[model samples]
Target: MELNNKKVKELLPQKEPFRFVDYVDDVDKNNKTIQCNYTFKSDNPIFLGHFPQEPIVPGVLLIEAMAQSAILLMLCIGNEISLDGEKYLLSKVEEVRFNKPLFPNQKANIISKIERSIPHFYFFSSKVYNGFEDKILEGKFIVFKK
Candidate 1:
């Protein structure tokens, strides 16, 4: 299913300034993969201090974006998970690498796949790519559902 910005807001637990996902392009439940997009607004306050001269999107926020996408994947698939009264927390991040820096106003495509899953923990491999299709970051992370 394609989740637009409105649906993304409804499904995502984060609020403005914190929510990274703007929309979901696709959700392949059978393959356990999801594709989403987020644009780093030039007016974001972080750019002001991250670097006064040459502001760039922090690497940590990129990871958060992937984590958010992972959560969306879990909720969209047939895992029977719901946010009605549940919370999903990022429990771990591993083998993360930043290949390129993203600047303000740049749109990134976040792609994530379920690597494996245990009772209440889900492992995922995620990647973020720039508009040019260049990979900017890649990593593996785990999410704990409560």
Candidate 2:
């Protein structure tokens, strides 16, 4: 199904600097796969304090990105994953592995596939890749409907 990035942003509640996933570039319902890309811009608040000199996107945000990706996939399939105007609430996180670091201006390509989702209980496996095609992070995320 076709989705708008701007509308998707509205579905997400994280807002501005805190929300890392920028757009849902594409999605496949039959395959249960999604591809999205985001960039860490210099005009953000977190960078000012994250290092001031060697600024980079935090690892927590990377994991959050994976969770957000799973939420978006849910929305794409059902169009009602957002609860009472809220989009995501991470319930469980497992098998988290940080393979590399993410730096400013780098494009984060997040790909997620549903392990299972029925009702509010959802599980997904996700991976993050830099613009250069190197593996940056990977994890499994779980979310429940509120």
Candidate 3:
């Protein structure tokens, strides 16, 4: 199912200025993968201190974006695991590589595939791409649902 901004907001716990995911373009429950996107606004406060001269989206935010995408995919897997009354938290981030910097007003395409899942934790292999298809970042994220 495709999750638009409003639907995404309903599923995610984050609010504006903190929510990085703008929309989820695709979702594959069978494959446990999702494709999502986020557009950076020029007036984002992070730009103020991140370097007013050459502001860039922080790598941390990129990681959060990927996590959000992964969480969305997990929720779509089935109603059994949907977010009824639970919280998803970031547990670990491994082998994270930042290839390029994301600037204001630029959109990022995020693809997240679940590599594996434990009893309460899910590991995901994720990548962020620019409009040109160039990879901006790649990493493995572990999230704990509790």
lDDT of all predictions:
0.93, 0.82, 0.90
Predicted structure 1, TM vs. truth = 0.96
**lDDT, candidate 3, 43-113, per-residue tens:** 88889999889899999999999998888888888565358888899999999999999888889999999
Candidate 2 residue-wise lDDT at 60: 89
Q: Pick out the ten consecutive residues of candidate 1 with the lowest summed lDDT.
A: 77-86
Residue 121's C-alpha lDDT in candidate 2?
Answer: 82
Against the true structure, what is each candidate's TM-score?
0.96, 0.87, 0.96
Residue 96 of model 1 has an lDDT of 99
**Tens digits of lDDT, candidate 2, 119-139:** 868888999999999999988
User: Each model's RMSD to truth, in Å?
Assistant: 1.1, 2.1, 1.2
| Poorest 10 consecutive residues by lDDT, candidate 2 | 79-88
lDDT tens per residue, model 1, 2-60: 99899999888998989999999999999999999999988899999988799999999
lDDT of 2 at 37: 78
Output the TM-score of candidate 3: 0.96
Query: lDDT of candidate 1 vs native?
Result: 0.93
Model 2, residue 87: C-alpha shift (Å): 5.7
